[model samples]
Target: MAWLSQYQAIVYGNGANGPILQGGRSVTEQAIISSETRQAPQGKMSALALSALGIVFGDIGTSPLYTFKTVLGTAEMPSDPATVLGALSLVLWTLFVITTVKYVSFAMRVDNDGEGGILALMALLGVKKHHRPSIVAVGLFGAALIYGDGAITPAISVLSALEGVNMATPALQPYVVPAAVVILLALFAIQSRGTAEIGHFFGPIMLVWFVAMAVMGVAGIARHPMVFAALSPSYGLSYLFSHGMTGFLVLGAVFLCVTGAEALYADMGHFGSRPIKLAWFGIVFPSLILNYAGQAALVLEGAPTDGNIFFRLCPEPLLLPLIGLATIATIIASQSIITGAFSMTRQAIQLGWLPRLYIKQTSSEGYGQIYVGVVNWLLMIVTVGLTIVFGKSDNLAAAYGIAVSATMLMTSALLFIAMREIWGWSVWAAGFVAGCFLVVDSAFFLANLTKIAEGGYVPLVLALLIYGVMWIWHRGAAAVSQRMREALIPVDDFMKRTQAAGIPRVPGTAVFLTRAERDIPPVMVWHVKHNRALHEHLFVLRVEIRSVPWVFGEQRLTIEEVAPNFWRAEAHFGFMERPHIPELLAASKSLGCTVDLADVTYYVGHETVIHRDDGMGMPAWQEKFFAVMERNAVHVSDFFSLPNDQVVEIGRQIAI
Candidate 1:
C-alpha cells in the first residue's frame, strides 16, 4: 500500500490520469524508482555483484577457453610473436571498449522502466504496432538473433571445454564429441528443476574459476614477460596496417572475445546495473585480461602451434583436472544463455510480440526463474545437432559472432534513439556517441561476413525465420484488434439500447472479458443477439498489464457502477504478475461488487483467422502463418487462470 502511494506521487501526480485508480501509480515509474533505491546499501550490492559473476559473466567469462586459440588459428594470422601479440592487443581492447565502455557504461543506462535488453530498449523508445513499426521490426530481429547466439554459445562453449580432454590423452579424443553431447543433454534436462536450487554454488565456483585464471595467467606471464607489450594500442594498430586485408579478416576471430557482451545488457534486469558493473570491473574483467595475456605469453614462449594454447598452458599432470574445471565453467556459461533465452521469451509474451507459451515459474521468490518447455527442448535439439554437424569448436566458432555483431549494431541504433528521446541529449551529441559504437559494431559484422560459407549462415537464417514469425504475429494481432474495434459498440449506448429492448434478464452473473475497457465486448453482443437473454448482474472486465514487476492487492482493481445491476471493473497487473480471474473477482468485492465464484460464468472471444488477398494489409502467406500461430497460441482462458468449466467461448471469423 505504501508502495502504491509512492507510485501515485510519481506516476499520476502530474495529472496524467487522476484518482479513478487501480494501482495508485504507473508500473513503469515504480520499477525505475525501486531499481534506484535498491542500489543504496553496500552489503546487498556486493552480494548481487558476486551473484552476477556467475550468471552475467558466464558467457564472457568462459571466452578465454577458446578465444585466443581461435584468433591465433585464423587463416590470416601466422603463428609468430608479433601476430600473436597483435591479436592479444585486439582482444584486450575489444573487451575493454565493447564490454566495459559500451555496455557497462552506456547501453545499460537505456533501460525500459527498470528492465534492459534489445526489446526493453525498444519499449523505452516507445515502439508500437503503429508508431515506428520499422524500429519494432529491428528490435524483434535483434531479439531473434540472440536465440541464434543462444544455440551456438552452448554448443561451442561445451565442445571447446570438452576438447581439452583430447589434450590430456590421445586415447580420449574419440570420446570428446560424445562426452559433450551427454553434458549438453544433461544440462537441458535439469533446466526444468530451475536454477535456484544449484544457483548458490555457481557464484563460488565461478569465483574459483576466475582466481585460477589469474594464477595460471600470472604463471604463464612469468615465463614470457614480453607478452605485456600487447597492452599498448600501437601493437594492434601496427598489425592492422602491416598485414592489410589479412589483419582485417583476423578481426572476425578477435570479435569472439566480446561475443557475450549483449548478455551483460540482456541480464541487467536480473542483476541491477551497479552489481553487473561491479562484477565486470572487480573480477571478470581482470581475470579475462590476465588469462588472454597468459595465452599469448604461452604462444610467444614456443608452445606448440597446433591451436590448443589454453590446455598447453597447464602442466601435464593438471591437464585432466583443468579439463574438468573448464567443462563445469562452460556448462555454467551455457546455462546463462539458456536462462537468458527463457527470460527474453517471457518479455516478448508480456509485450505482445509473441503469443503466450506455457511459462512455468520455477521459483516462488525470484520472478526471473522461469521455464518454457518449447524453448528448452528446441534449444537442446539445435545445440546437439550443431555439435554433431560442426563436430568441433573451431568450426562452430565461425557461426558465432555474426548474430552477436548484428545484435550489437541494432542496440547501438536503439541507444542513439534513446539518447535523444529518453535521456534528452541533443541529436549531435547522441549521434556522436552512437557513431562510435556503430563503427565498432559494423566492423565486427562485416568482418564476420566472410564466415558465411563456412557456417555463419546458420544464425542469420534462424534470425530471419524468427523475425518473420514475430512480424506476422504483430501485424496479425493488430489487424484483429482493428477489426474488433470496427465492430465494437460503445458500452453506454449498448447498455441503453439493451435496456429499452426489454430483454429478459437471467438469474446468474455473467462476466465479459473485453479488450477495451469503455467498449462493449463483441462476444457479449453476439451472446445477447443469439441467446436472447441477459444476466441480472453483469460485469465487463478488462485486464491491464502494467510496466512494473508487481502491484499491491488493494490497488489491483477499480470498479464503477455503469447502470442498474451492471458494473465495469479494470484489473491491473504488473508485467511480471500472473492474472487469476476468480481471485480478482473476490478482490472486487471490497469495491462494492457482490459476486459468488461458483455462480459466475465468463465469456471470451475466439477468432478464426481467414486469409484474404484483397489488400486487407497482410500478404496471403503471412496471413496463413499468422493463422497457424493463432491456432497454436495459449488460450485466453488458460493465460488468465480462469477455470475451464466456468468459461464459455464465443467464436468469430476475422479476415486479414
Candidate 2:
C-alpha cells in the first residue's frame, strides 16, 4: 500500500488513479501532457533511423518476397489485370492504414516508460497478476500469439526466399526445403553469441535490398504504367463486390502484406518512435509499395502466373544476386523475432507472470540485447518443424496471418483501455478510435479463420498452450504469495519477542531475501526458532521490480531500521535490469547502511509445495503442476547473483 501510494504520486501526480484529484483540479491542469516524455538520445537521429531500417523493418520489409505470389496463387480469381490491380490496391491501403497510421501514428504514443508491446500496454493500464483477469488474459494471450508469429515468421520468410532458387531452375526445387532448414538451424545456432558485432551491417544490407526492390519495381512499372491505376480504392472495392466469397477470402492472403506491423510498435523501445517512423516513411514504405506494384505490373504484362512473381520481376542477369540478398533479408527478419522473444520472456519473468529462467545480457550498452537458451532452442525446434511440415512458404503462409490478426485485435482492445485510463479520453472519442482498428483487425481475423483447415490451426494451438502456461503460473504464484502472507509474522513484533526471550546473537550479518518487506520472513523465524540464535546484523531484503525500464541510483534502495541491529531494505529494479546482490549491497552505503559484502551470508527460503484435496483456491491438477514448476525453477542464489557457497537455503513445506 505504501509503494502503491508512492507509485501513484510518481505516475499520476496525485495518489489516485482517477483523472481528477481533490479540489476539482484535473490531473493535467498544470501543463499539457504529451504522449511520451522520454525522447530518443540526442545527436543520434541519423544513425538510429538507419538502425531502425534493419531491426524495425526487417519483418515487414521482407514481406514483399512472398506476399504477391501467395495472393495470386491462393485466390480463386484468375490472374488478370483486374485481379492483380485489385490485390495490389488492397495491399497498399492495408500498409497505409495499419502500419503507417495506426501503429506509427497512434500505438507508438501509448508506451510503458518508452517500452512498447502488448505486455507493455497491459502494464501501462496498471493491471497486475491475478487482477483484472479478463484484461490480463487478453494481454497474455496476445503476447503468446506473438511467440507463434515468431516461430512461423522465420520458417515462411526463409523458405520463401529459398524458393527463389526454384524460379531459376525447376531441377533445384528438391533442395529448397533442405537449404531453408540448414539456414534456419545456423541462424538459431549463432543466437548465443549475440548480434552486436554483426548488427551494424544489417542497415547497409537492408538499404541495398530496398534500393534493389525500388529499381526492379521501376523497371516493371516503366513497361506498363497502367499498374498505377491500382492506387485507387475503387478497384479493390469493386473486385470484392464482383466476386462474393472468393473476394473476401482473398483478404487472408492480403493480410500477409502487413504481417510484421506489430514489430514496428513492439520494437519502439529499441529504436524510438521518431527513428522508426522516419525509416518507415523514408525507405521501407516506398520500397514495399513499389515492389508490390511491380509484381502487379509484371502479371499484367503477361508474365506466367504459376511462377514466383517476386523473383520473375527481377532481370535474368541479377536473379542469383537477388536471391542472395533476399536470403540475408529473411535471416535478419528471423533475428528480429528471436530477439523479441528474448525481451518478452524477460518482461514476463520480471512481472511475475512466469518463473525465472537463465537470462544472459548480450550487450552492456544495449539493454534490449539478451539471450535465453530455453526460448532460443524451443523456437528453433518449432521453426524447423514448421519448415519440414509445411515444406514451402505457400503452406506456411496459411499458418502465419492467424496469430498476427488475433494479436492486432487484442492490441486495439488494450489501446482502448489506455486511451480512457492514461490519456483521459472521453468514452466516445476512445471508442471511435478503437472501433476503427477493431473493424480492420476483426475483418482480417475472420478472413484468416477461413484458412483453419488449410494449416491456420497451428498458431492457434500454439497460442492456447502458451496461454495455459502463463495463466497457471500467474495463478499459482498468487496463491503461494497469499499463503505466505497469512503465515508471516510482523518484523517488529518478532524482534521484540526474540529480544525478550534473550536469544543468543551470532557474529556475522545474515541477509534474508524475502517478498514481503514489512514482515519477518518465515525462513528467518524458523531458523531463529530452531537454533535459538540470531545474527548480530540481520537484514530482510526485498527486491521489487518496477514497470519502468530503468531506476535511478538514488532511488534504488530504501532502508528502514525496524529495531536495533534489524533492518528492512527494499531494493528497486526495473524490468530490464538483472539483480546483482553484491553490487546492490555496495551501493547501499549511500543509504547509510554499513553492509560488509564479503562477510554477509545470504539466507533464502525454499518452498516445498503440496497438493491436497482441501478447499484451496486451485484445482489439484493445477496445484501439482505448480509444485513441479516451483521445484524446477532456477534457485534463488543464482537468480539474485549471489555466491553459491555463502547462500543457505532453508526449506519449508506448504499446502495450497
Candidate 3:
C-alpha cells in the first residue's frame, strides 16, 4: 500500500514501457513526480492497470500465437488428454512462476533508485566493466545478449502474426514474408517519428486483443471442462517425469510463454510495480492462462490445427479479424524490445561500456520515444535477415528463447547479490530464494541450448559480437581515462608556475570539461601552454553519472571556488538522464556561482589512440579496435548539447 501511494498520480498513463521513462526521461512523470499528493482518484489503479496492458504485457500477451504450436511440435506426441494437459500445465505454471513470481513479485523489489534493468541492476551492485569480476562480467554479458533478443523478437513476433494470413487465405502464404518485411520496415521507419501520437491507441487496442484472446480461450475451454485439470502442478510434473528427455526438451518451447517476462521488471520504473502487478493478476495473468488453456483444449478435442492452433480457436467468420488484431499486437510487442534496446544503449554509453552513438530524441512526449540510428538500423537488418532466412514462425522459434534464458539466469545471480548487499538477507535465505529461480532458469537455458544447431546460434553469435565490442570499449576507455589522469597537473603547482611565468588573462568564462575533480586537466595545460593565456573566469566542470536513476534539485550540482574566479563544479547526472552542460551551468548560479550564458566558451579533448609496441597496454589488435571505435564515436559537443560555435577541441594522442 505504501508503494501504491508513491504512484497515486500516474493517472491516464499509456506511455511505452522501458528504462527510458524513468525519473529523468519521462514527461508524463515529470508533470506528476514532483508533487506529493497522496489522494488519488478512485479509478487511478484501474486506469494505470489499463494503460499497462499495452506497454507491459504486449509481448507475453501474444505468446499464445506461437508458444502452444511450438510446444506441441517439440512434444512430438499425441494430442491425448494426458499430453495436452501436461503441456498446458507446463505453460500455465511457467507463466505463474517465471513471469509473475520471479519478475513482477521478486525482481521488481530490487530496483535501483526505482529504475530496473540488467544495467541498472549492475549499477546497483557497483559492478563496473573495468573491474571484470566474474559476476560483473556475467551481468554485462547478459545485458549484451539482450541486443540479440532485440533483433530476434521483432522478426519472430511479426512473422508469427503474419503466418495467420495463411489460415485465412491459403494462397497468400507466398507473400507473408514480403508483407512482414514491409510492416517491419514501416515500424523502424516510423520510430524516428515517435510513438507519442499513436501510443494512446496502444492501450485500447491491446485491451481488445486480450479480451479476444480470453474469449477465444473460454470458448474452447467450454468444449471440455476437464481442461481445467491442467491447471494443477501434478499434470506438468507427471508429464515431465513420465516423458523424461522429451518433456525436458519441451521446456524450451514452454519457456517461450514467459519470453517477455523481463519487460515486467524493466518497465517497472515507467509504471510503478503496483499497476503492473494489478495488470498482471487482474487482466494479463488470467487472459494468458485462458488463451493457453484454450489452445490446449482445442488440440485435445481432436480439432485439426489449420496451419496454426491459435487461429483455429476462432470461428471461420472471425478468423481474418483475429489475424489482423494479432498483426497489430505483434507489432506493439516488437516495438517494446526495439525501444528497450535503445534504452539499454543510452545506459551503456553513460556507464562507459559503450561508445557514444548518435542518439535522436524523436519526441518531446517522453524520452522513451528516442531513436538510436546505429542500434535501430542494425536491429532492422538482423531482424529482416532472420525473418527471410527462417521464413516461418516455427523456424524462428528455434532461434529464439536462448538469449532471454541466459539473461534471466544472469538476473537471478545478480538478485542473489542484491539480497545480501542491499536487503541484508542472510546467505542461506538469499541462496534458497535465488536457487529456485536458478534451477528453473537453468533448466530453460539448458533446454534452449538444444536449439543452437536448429538456428539458435543466430542470436548467440550476435550477443557474442556485442559483448566483444563492449569488453574492448570499456577496458579501452578506462585505460585512456587512467592515462589522462596520470598526465594531469596538480592545480596548485600548475597555477603557481603559470603565475610565475606571467600568463596573459583573457576576460571571459572558459569552461573546460574534464574528468578531474581537483586538478588541472591536460587540455587546460595544453591551452595555457600553447595559447599563452588564461581566462579571467575559468570553470573546471566534471560531469558525473551516478548509479541511481535520478539526481535532482540541490543534489545535482556541487560547486566550490578552488581559487579566486576559478571554480570547480561537478554536475551529477543519473545514467537515465540526458545531460546538457549549458543548462546545468546556467542552473549553477542558484548554488552561489555566477555564469554568463552568452559569453561562454567550452573546451574538450579529442584523443587519438596509438598502440604501445612494448605491450604495456592492451594487445595491438585491441588498440586498433579501440582506435576505430574512437574514430566513429559521436563528438563531445553534440553529446553534451554544447554550442558548436563556442566549443573548442584540444587534440592529444594517447599511446595505450
Candidate 4:
C-alpha cells in the first residue's frame, strides 16, 4: 500500500488487465533488483513476482533442457554409468553452491539506484571524474564482456534446445537448423510487440516447464533411488581429483550450468531483485536440482544409445512431445539473451562509452521490450552460423562459459574496487570475498580455454573484436572533440561583442541540447557573439546519465536568473532514459514557465571530427577507427527531434 501510495500520481485505473496512463509515465521494474519502485499498478508484489519469473527463470528454466545431455555426451554413446551419475551429482551441487548461495543470497544485495547488473556495479565503482583512465577501462571492459556474453547466449540456448528434437526423433535431425532459424526469427520479430503484452504468460509457461522437468526427473530417480547419494560434496570433490589431466578439462562443460546466472543481475533493472531471488530459492532451484539428480540416477542404472540423458529421462512413448516442449522453452531463453544485448547497447550509448547506434523503444512503459535492427540481424547471422558450424550444442558449450566466466571474474575484480574505493568497505573483508570469487571464476575460465579448438573460438574472437572497436572509438573521438573545442570561440567574448553591436533582441526562447553538463558549448559561445542579445529565455541543457535505464524521471530544468532578463535552464536524462527537449519544454507549464512550443528555437552543436595526424596520443589504427566512427555517428539535429525552422547547427572541426 505504501509503495502504491508513492506511485499514486502515475497510477490510473485499469481497463481489464491493461493499465491506463494517468498524470505522467510508468517504467517497468526487473527482478533481482532492490529498487524502490515497480512498473505502476501496485509497485511492490506484482512487479516482484513478474521480475522473479522473467529474470532468474530464463537461465535455469532452460538449463534442464541441456545440462545433463551435454555432460554425458562428452563420453560418447553408451555413457559410462558410474561417470554419468558422478557428473550429474556434480551439476546438482554446483547449482546449489553457485546459484542458491553466491547469487540469490548475497550478490543481489549490491545494487546501484535499485538497478542490478554489471554496468550498475561498474557505475557504483567508476570514478565520477573523467580523468581516471583505469576506472574507465574497467567500465569499458565490463561492457565489452557483456556484449560478448550477449552474442553467445542466444546461440547456445537455442542450439541446445533444438538438439532435443534431434535426439527424440532422428528424423527431425535435418530440420534442426531450419527450426532454429524460424524460432530465432520469431523471437526477434516479437520484440517490437513489447514483453508486457506477453509477460503475464511467462510465469505460467515457466511454471509448466519446471513442473515437467521435475516430473520427468522424479520418475528416473524412482527407478534408481541410490543416485541420491551423489548429493554429497565428496562425490564432486572425488571426481575432480581422481580424473587425472582430463579432470581439469571437464570444468569447461560443468561451468555451462551457471552461464545465465549473471543475467539474473544484468536484467535486474527490468525485474525487481526480490522476485528473482524468490524464484530461484522457491521454484527454479528445487526443480533444477531434482531434474539433474534424476538424470544422474538414470545414467547410473543404464546408459542410453546416443548419450542424451535429458531426452532419455522421458519414456520413449512421450519423447517427441517432451522434445517439442523443451524446444519452446529454449526459444524463450534465447530470446531473453537477445533482448539483454539490445538493453546493454542502449546503456553503453547513453553513458558515452559507445558510439550511438539507432535505438527504438517498443513499449511506452515497458523498457525491457526494444528493437534494434542492427543488433537483431547481426545476432541472427552469428547465431545461425554457430549452429551450422558447431553442429551440436555440446561444442558450443566450451565457448559459452568462457566469455560469461570472464565477465563474472572481471565484475568481481571491479566489485573489490567498489568495496575499497567507493563503499569504503574494509580491505580484508573485500579481499576475502572477491578473492574467492576470482578463484572460482578463474578455474572456469581456464577450463573453457581448453575448448578453443573444439568450437570455443567463436565467442573469444567476438569478444576481442568488440573490445578493440570500443577502445579505438573512445580514443579517436576524444582527440577529435578536443581539437574542435580548441577552435571554438570563447563564450565571454561572444556575448560581449554581440551586445556591443546593438543587434535586435530575439522574441523566442533558444534551447541548446548539449552533451556536457558544465562547460558552455562552443556553438553557444559563437551564437552569443553573433546575436548581440539572448532569447527571452536561454537554456543550455545536457542529459545526465543515471546508473539505471528508464527508471528515474527526467531532471527538472534548473532555472537560474543570470542577468535581469537572461535565464538558463539545465535538463538532465538518465543513461537509460531518453530526453525529448521539445516535449519537456512544451510541458514546462507545470514548472511555472510559459513558452509557445512553435515559437521556441532549438539549437544543436554538430562536430565534424577528422584525422590530421595531430593532437593527443593516439595510435594509427585508432585514428582510422575514429574516422570510421565519426562517419558513423549520427548528426545532433537528427538524434534529438528538433524542427528545421527552429534548429541551428554550428560545425566545429577536430583532428586525431
Best by TM-score: 3
Question: Stretches of candidate 2 above 4 Å error?
Answer: 1-43, 553-555
TM-score of each: 0.91, 0.92, 0.94, 0.87
Which pairs in model 2 have colliding backbones?
none
Candidates in order have lDDT scores of: 0.80, 0.80, 0.82, 0.64
Q: lDDT of candidate 4?
A: 0.64
Lowest lDDT sum, 10 consecutive residues, model 2, at 13-22
Scored against the true structure, residue 143 in model 4 reaches a CA lDDT of: 65
Top candidate, metric lDDT: 3
Order of models, best TM-score first: 3, 2, 1, 4
Residue-level lDDT of model 2, residues 1-656, one tens digit each, is 34322211222100011111112211122111112213434555665677677777889999998888888886665577788888889899999989988899899999876778898888777775436877888989999999999999999999889899887887999999999999999999998777767776777888999999999999888878999999998998888778788888888999999999998888776556887888898888999989999889888888887867899889888999999999999999889888888878878887788777777655433334467888899999999999999998988888989999999999999989988988999999999999999998998999999999999999899999888888888889878777888888887688789989999888888999988756888889888877798888888899987776556646778897787777789987666556667767777777877655557999899989886457856898888888887887778787777878898888888778
Better of 3 and 4 by TM-score: 3
Q: What CA RMSD would candidate 1 show? A: 5.9
Q: How displaced is residue 152 in candidate 2, in Å?
A: 0.4
